[model samples]
Structure formats: structure tokens, C-alpha cells
Target: MALAVTCSISISSSSSSSSTFQSSQPKFSQIASIRVSEIPHGGGVNASQRRSFVKPPQRSRDSIAPLAATIVASDVAETEQDNYQQLAVDLENASPLQIMDAALEKFGIHIAIAFSGAEDVALIEYARLTGRPFRVFSLDTGRLNPETYRFFDEVEKHYGIHIEYMFPYAVEVQGLVRSKGLLSFYEDGHQECCRVRKVRPLRRALKGLRAWITGQRKDQSPGTRSEVPVVQVDPVFEGVDGGVGSLVKWNPVANVKGHDIWSFLRTMNVPVNSLHSKGYISIGCEPCTRAVLPGQHEREGRWWWEDAKAKECGLHKGNVKQDAEAELNGNGVANTNGTATVADIFNTQNVVSLSRTGIENLTKLENRKEPWLVVLYAPWCPYCQAMEESYVDLADRLAESGVKVGKFRADGEQKEFAKRELGLGSFPTIMFFPKHSSRPIKYPSENRDVDSLMAFVNALR
Candidate 1:
């Protein structure tokens, strides 16, 4: 069973040859006034104010930054010569949290960063040294093995930075468990588990945050080759604000890739993960991790069985489906900031940040008689294309008429199951699943263009 890489929104840009859209960002916010960051000296702000990011010098064909830590300001300067010294000092000795705090103090916003393993320790050390707590902190979806945990503990002790965790929402996890338990991920392979645990958590963790950072590097993967300075919109970060909001992700270690991270630790005199000396090129949760052998890419250890398509755990590199209703339309996207738009509702890149900690609604959703049409379309499917705007419009009309409308996508590896349960005949299919009913009322294969598609959807019982 080939795990066909599909996107919920397509990012049609200069680079479309590959299905996966690299994490390169095109920020639209002002450098000094980024929404979530607060920098005292010179970081800009606002939705349309992010053009001053002085991107690091490109190393090679590869150079993707992480969502965990973004470059809030590229050209920050208190004094020309003094600012240069400050940046140099930041690069030389600053904790991950310190870097984040400094950016926030300067830019007036928050940021994000992820920990694959010990490499995160360096980020932590920087945070500790500079007394700057990170804006966002997370771990991958795969289960972490003992060694990795031990190393994490060691780093916490060494740097005293309490790393925050981001996981998938329990509601979805329970839903998955009701359908398939923990072992189901193994049977379903990487993508399904990634979607349920990793991707969903990242989505929730990043909700409402302004800027996100990552520990990503283009050299890490062949897929991340054509990275750019700033991206206006991306497929993976769909359904969120402007989709082109400022990305304050900073790769302090961009110049450092494929090198011995553990060796660097020894040089820095940092406590190292004992296992690094062995062969663990990439360190993440244990269940889905392993040690990369010689003559292999760093990521070769992560889900060695799956192809590049299945390797992603969802939070980092995934597809985008832009054809759906614009997240801004329909019932009207709620006004959050002064400059609210459809992009923020959907394609915003802040990954899942689970709140309401320990409080979960376990009760199953009691089927209701209210009419609804659950959409089961892949981001890559053409049928679901351009359906977002119509859906939002329909949602708007329904709300005005006192009707409830909802959306659901057939993402991950379970589309086959959806096809079986919903009797899907083609892509971009929308089945009317009325409330109080257990199954969906299948629609016929008819005119699918915008005109009839909305009409058929409007007539759902």
C-alpha cells in the first residue's frame, strides 16, 4: 500500500515539481512590529510589516528553517557597529529561550522551537545563558526512547530550561483509539500516525501564536532543496492568517549541518547524549526512531521502512490544499487582530499547542438530526479544489438561516476506510451526514463545477 503524498492546499509557486512544499516562508508582517513578538529596539509589527528579515547567507541548494525558532528581525541594530557586536554575541552565546525572549522584547511577539534530541540542548543552553525563555517548545510525535529521555533530563538539569511539550488533541486521539489503538499507527505506517499524533498536535500547539520557529535544515533532507528567503504562502500552513505572515524562525545553526552534533557538544563542553557516539544521526521519539548507519542521510534513521512520502511526522513538512473555501469567508472569520483575514484562520504556521491541560471531553459525539455535509477530499485532489470559498459562502448563508454546517477532510492514510464507510466514488466528494444519523447520504456523480456544487451542497438534508 503506497502512502500517496497528498496536500489539503496546493502551493503553486516557482517550485511545483515536487508534491511536498518546503518550509521556506514568505513573511508579510513588518520586521519591528510582528504580531506575537515584542522587541524593544527595532523589530517591526503588524500583519503587513515583515519585509526586513535579513536571512542568513544561503549555504547551498538546501536551507529550510524550523518552525520552532524563527528569525524575528534580520536587521536589528541599536547602533550600527554595536548591533553587529550584539548579533555576533547572540550567535556565539545565547540560550534558545534567551534568543526567543530577546526577539520578543525587541519584536514584541512569541516564537516556537522543536526538539528532535540533544541538539535541542544547545538551544536550551543558549536560552539559559541569555535568560530568554523560548516562545514555543515541542517534541515530535513518535514515542521517545529511554536514552533520548535521559538526555533530555540531563539537558534540563544542565540548562534549567523547562521544555514545553506539544501533542495532538486527545479528542482526535480518542477518536482514533476508538477506531484503532496505539498499535494502529504501526499497522497504518508513518503518515497516519503522524497525522493523528504529530501533525494534529502541532496544529493545536501553534494555534493563536503569531510566529513559529523550527530546527529544520535543508541539508537534512533531499526534499528541502529549493528553500527561499521569505515565502508569501505555503501549503502546509494553510487555514491560518495571511498564510504569508512573518516567520521569525532563526536557524543559528544553519551553517552547521551533517556535522557531528555530539562532537560539537564535546567542544562546547556540554553534556552529550550517550547514544550519539554510536550512530544516531537523528534523535527523536524512540518508537519511530533508530540510529542511522554510515553512508546514510541523517534522517535515514527515522521510519527507515517508509519512503520520503511517509517519513514526515506531519508538523514539519506536509501538503497544502488551497482549493477549499477561503478560511475567511462563509459565516465570516472572527476578528482577532485588527487585520484579520482568511489566511490566519487556516494556513497560519503556528503548530498545534494543546491548552486546557488535563481537561478532556471523553463523551462520544451523539449523532444529531441536524443536517451537515462532511467533506472527504484530499488536499491534492482537484475536486476539493476551489471548494473552500464556496463552503465558506454556504456556511455564511446557513448561519444566516439558522442552520449548522461543518467540514471534514479525508487526510492521512485512512481515505480507503472513508471510501468504504462513506461510499466515496471520486475525489472532492461531499456526503451529507445529517445529525442523528449514523451514515452519510451519498451524492451522485453530477456537475461538480462551482455553480452546481454549491447548489447541491445547499440542498443537503
Candidate 2:
């Protein structure tokens, strides 16, 4: 059976060592090279200190495991429901170290810490103190800051552990870039980019593990993450066994405050990203993250361009009621209750609604010897709504030109056609299909005005 285990850790002044193993124990030469006193205290390594370390050699794409190779079969017995409940109760108020110890002992090599930012490195420190064989991995989104990649190398060397780097599928990434361009997320949303870059790679990484750990805290985003439990079954991800109920997710620092994590990092001398010293709190892809002002929350630095409520990137959104597909589609349309109906889109003037059959009929347009303009849009999209007046005006003005203008509301029944066949990654995507051509030319101008739309089609003719 597939099971997803999620647990939280509280911050408390407890014993630092989760095991009898001492940091002074010299097993690996790399670990012995740095003395405990050499690590700076109270904060992360300053800019000068960080630059002192030599950069590690970079690995090639062939050296990293493919997504399919990461899925390992599992034979671990499932934890009884009652026992699992007790485990949660026991760790509810436990210190981060204690929580880490329990997880490391139970899952052993089958569990890994999903290391990314400073908080995750703190978890790495805690895992090191446990003295047991543990695993660490990072999702290489291929768009991360150079400093972040250097930091990953630093952590691996500092902790004397091998960190498996997971990457997104090359084909999916190429397809997204070829169709939408490299920076389409700026126009639409970050969800699609994140899905191709982070979420899918994480899914592949988790496929081989019975449990994984994160550094999520309830206090990070009070609006979205306030209810994070100290320990519970993960409702979203499956485990290494490939069964429906076998994987466990551990958020050891779920109850730990941000300051407390920094303190742990400082006290333990964990390696951290240099960007942290520059004021970036919550780090993701380089393009999406920024340094926040003194009063702003850490999460504010991530995806700051979008609405505050829509900050998540889908990794932690499995249980949330938000429309996963719409978010990934980057249509800027929320699938809340009472969403706009098909009539709302069809009622507009100069707009022809296209159904599945209607889309199929478009092939006949190739024979009609008439260039046509079409928009794949979602009715609830604010951008699509804003373009309505201009679009209608453009259609009416172009009627005498013998160029057909139409739109497809990519919602409900027609979503599949828009997404799969048309490759509609974002809403209000205007395309001009020339007569006798199956390939449609995308609207080239960023300015969504009637004149601009007319100029595009007129130039084509």
C-alpha cells in the first residue's frame, strides 16, 4: 500500500547531538579538513569567507540519473495506523534534532532530505549529528543562481555526503521553450515554468524513497502554510514502494521559526547560499526570487509579481483546493466555485465559440483560402477580460478583409483541445493561421491593442 508520512519539528533548546557521534570523529578527510571553530557563528558565511572556498567540479548530464532510473522498488512493511498516529504524537513537540534522529533511524537510506535553501542545510546539520546513513538530494531547475549551485557543492563537501541532483526532462523543457519562449512565465504565471522545472523533478526524486524531509515552517506563509502539522500522512505523494499509500514526508522544522533555523545554521556551522547574506529570504529559481525589505515576509521575495495568495509553485499545493491544471496552464484564471460559464464567453459580440467539433471544422478553413485569427482564452482570466473590447473591435474592423476571427474559451469541455492539440500554455494567446497552412503564427507584439493585432495580420497578408 502507498502511504505518505508527513511530520513536523518544533524549535526548542534541547541537546544538540541526536546521537553519541561527535563532530571531531574523523572518518572522511574532507570532513576533517575544516575545524569546528573555523565555521562562523551567529550568521552564515560572509561574502569574503564564502569566496575563499574553491569551487567543486561540475557533473555532466549523463552522470545524473534519468527520471525513470530513480524509481526503486520497495519491500518495506507499512506502519500500522495506530502506531503511525503515536509517532506523530511523540514528535509533535520534539526538538528538530530529535525529529531528525527518529526519521533517520526509521527510514535509513530510504529517506533523504530535500535540500534547497538555508533551512534545508540546517536539516542536513541535524541529520549529520544523527551519525546514521542518510541521503540528500536537490532539484536542479537549470535556472537557479550560480551561487545556489556553488552552495550545493559546498554543502556536500562540508557534510561529507553525496547529494543526488535531479533534473527536468529535456524534451518537456525544450517543448515549453520552443512554444512559449524562455521567459513566458513573466507574461502569464510562474506555475508552468515551475512545473517543468521543479515539481516534475521532485516527483521523480520521491519515487525512490519511502520518506523525504523538508524545512517547511508554519510561520513562513501564514496565509497558506499556517495549518502545517508536525506529523501526518501526506495526502499527495506516493512512496518508494509504488503503492497507493507507502511514502512518508517529513517536515522536521514545520514548527520551527525562521530565526530559529538561522540560529541552528549558525550554531551548527552549516553551509548556506551566499544570496542569503544579500537579503534574499525564500530562494527559488533566480528569475523568480528577489530580496525583500526589512518588514516583508520571506515568501514575498518569491513570485512577487503575482497575487499574494497565489504564491505557491505546486510542490506543496496538492491538498489545496486550487485548480492544478489551470495554474500549470498559466491562464491566470482561478477555478473557484461559481466560475464563469460557457455562456459568459459566447455572449460576447464578434466572438465565435469553438467546441471540439468546431475545432475539427477549422481544418476546412485551410481549404477556404482565407487567413484566420483565433484566440485560445479562458473567460475568468483578467488579461482575457481586459482584451475583450479590443478583440471585438479588431474582429469587426477586419470583417471586410475576408480574414476570419474567432476564439476558444479553454475551460471545462474544451480545455483538452486547447491544451493538448493547440498547445495553449497561456490564455489570450492570439494566433494567425494562414490559409492552406496547418501551423498558426503567434501574435508577435506584446502590446495587445486593436491596431497592433490588425498590423500583425495585415503584415502576414
Candidate 3:
């Protein structure tokens, strides 16, 4: 939260070029880091009139994002860039989203907006403030859960950043789905399905691009073990533009964290996917997604049935060099690069399946309150166990102060309900449901002290 202050400063100056000033105003330490603004010269601080120096926060005004606002794609411009040079691309993780950013910076080209993870948001924000034109794009492989979409909306609205969507070709995807059903990828080798539904359109989406970035952290998967070069040669682009002839394949976040992303996002007011609160370390296609237990690998929740320690797609082909076409595919893809798009994530075409958390979920805690505070804890959590005392105390205080309350435990029998309903290890965590908030405050009392917890709760309250 921004703490705005009006401090009094006494200024005295001679009419000539030489000017001198003195002040009896006490310098509050809090204002030390704040930026200062001079009011219009004419009405500048009179001799004794206290100055309402609108001290700017220590950080850039854009450093902290505002509460989420509804995001409309139209809010984005079709093509926008002032100039592009001295572009710096960081691909610590080869995540596909990060791929979008590298390309923009490398080519001195401005994309829709640079797509980034929480780890990269600060730098991305820095670039935005510096007026670097970048485009951010994400390919929602039809399998994502609702949380991912909500996060997308949150990021766009919170930061006034636009994330462009890449959709699969409408015709081919329909034909494939109509013939094979939504789980067609499973019947066919996951590779073939990914190639047809995901890779193909993905390549097409990058056709006119100068560069494409990925969040492929080498430590996360085998396919991304290569050094996080600022550029790479894309296998798909045999003869495409700069991709085929230049360093197209890039991974900026190749060395970045699965955890730091959240910290970065939170710091930047980047709204995260609600599922993060539900113990989801990594989010992908919903049908293929499940909750990961403690100690499980981050990507394990995705493709749980695969049972393979390695996480990859046909694009990487299990990190194998040689391409095995029809013989390797359990199903069929007329060509590689599956036709998937952002719509698949949004389920914009309204694909129906038993794969969702369902309508009953939509009703949970709906109409509960304008600022319904839902707490997620674990029964075994010493912090939570002790919090029971603080919870009661905080609840009483909040009730007296006219605030609503609700709570859930991660280890409770109602866990699944809470998991699906509340979102898990995003923990000791407090959430405002239905209208997921980007900056839902975590309880501050690590000591579980009643006074500390109460202060934390009521302050956010």
C-alpha cells in the first residue's frame, strides 16, 4: 500500500540568481526514500505556508501496480513502438512465454508487449518505463484451468500491460477434434497431438516475428539443458525469416526460479493464477493437471499419468535429436506444430468436457461479501495451529469493525473442496474469492503472536 504524506518544508530565496533556504521541519525517516516534486514556481511555498510536497514513493510510480481492473483487449494498440535499440534479453528460463520477450529485445523490434514471468516482471516494467516496445504472447494449449486465464487478465489490467493471444487455426483444429474428440492428443502420441494442436499454430504465430522467447529453465526440463543463449536456431523454422537464418530459439529464464517468479510477480503487482494458492506449482492443460504433494517436482502435477520423471513435449521430443514422424506418433498429425491457441485455455469456443472443477465451484462463497477474506492453512502448520488463537481474536476484532471472515485448512478432509475452492500452498495465505485479488495479503505474524496477527489482519482489513 502507498503511504501518502504531506510534509512541511520552509523555503526562503533571494530574488537574484543566488538563493538560500532553511527549514525547521522535522525530516521523517519515512520520507527519506520518497521522490520530491516542486509545485508551479509562481505559487511555490510561501514563506510560512506549510508545503504539501506530494512526495513520491521511493520507487517508480509504476513500481507498485494498482488493484486489478477489468481487462479489455481493445485497450491494447495494434502496433506500437517509439524506437528500439540497446534491447537486452534475459532468458534464464526457456519458458515459452519468456521466448516472446527475447525476440523483441534482440531485434530492436517492439512487439505487442513483452510476455514475462513474475521473476522477469521487474525488468519488464523497467523496460516499459524506459519505452521499449515489446510484445507479450502466451499460447494457451486448450488444457489450462481457469486460474491461468484469470491471472492473464490480472496481469494485463494491473500493469496496463497487454498479453497477445496466439490461437490455433480454427478449421484444422475442429476437423481434428470432431474426428478424434478433445482427448485426441492422448490417443495419438502426446507428441503428435502437441505438434498438430500446439506446435503448428505456435510456429505460425511466430511467422512474422523478429524473435520468440521461452521460459525454458534448463534445470526444469531436459530439453532446455542448453545454455540460455540470447538466441538459438529454431527447429521448426527450417526456412522462415530471421528464425531460420538467425538466432531465433531463445531462453531468457533458463536459470531462473519456479519460486522467484511468484515473488517477482507479487512485487510487480502481477496477478497470479488462482491455482497457485491451491498447491499448483506449475499450471498447464487442466485435464492433464492435478495437485502436486509436498516434495513433488514442480512439473509433476502436469501429465500425472505419464509417470515419467522427464517433462517435455513433441517439440523437444524427449530431448531426442532425430525426428521420428508417423512411426513415433501414437496418433496422427498431418504436419508438425499442433494447432493450439490461447482460446484453448479460455475455452472460448466452449469445448465441453468432464474435465473442469465445475459449476458447483462457481457457486462456492459467491455473494459471500464484497471483501470476503478466506484463509488457507494446514492443520499441522504450527503457525496455523497457533493461528487458531489469533484467528479467533482477529475474527472478533474484524467483526466488531464490520468485516466478514472464512477459513480453510490444507490438510482437512475438506481439502479437495478447499483446493478446488480456495487454491492451496500459496499458504498461511488469505484470499478474496470469486473476484480473485492480486495482492491478497499473507498473514505477517510468523511468530503467531496475537498482537502481530491482529495488526496484520486489521491493516489489510
> By descending lDDT, how would the candidates be arranged?
2, 1, 3
RMSD of 2: 16.4
Question: Per-residue lDDT tens digits of candidate 2, residues 367-394?
Answer: 6567778888766544455567788888
Off by over 4 Å in 2: 1-86, 319-461
Taking all chains together, each candidate's TM-score versus the true structure is 0.45, 0.55, 0.44
lDDT of 1 by residue, 1-461 (tens): 11222221122121222223222333322322122222122343444333333432221111111321322234222221112222423343433334444444443222444565656555544433332224335654546677777876765555544455665566877887788777665666777767777776655555434345455444555333224111122235422122443233454443344464445555778766777777776676667777763324566567765433344566555322232434422112222343333231112111121112200110113465355544555443322433545545555555544344544443333446555655654444566655555555665643443456456656765
Q: Model 3 misses residue 315 by how many Å?
A: 5.0
Which candidate tops lDDT? 2
Cα lDDT, all candidates:
0.45, 0.65, 0.42
lDDT for 128 (candidate 3): 42
The residue ranges of model 1 lying beyond 4 angstroms of the native Cα positions read: 1-105, 129-136, 140-142, 185-187, 225-235, 238-247, 260-263, 318-461
Q: Locate the minimum summed-lDDT window of 10 residues in model 3.
A: 9-18
Give one clash count per candidate, in the order shown: 115, 14, 58
Error of 3 at 269 (Å): 3.4
Instruction: Put the candidates in TM-score order, highest first.
Output: 2, 1, 3
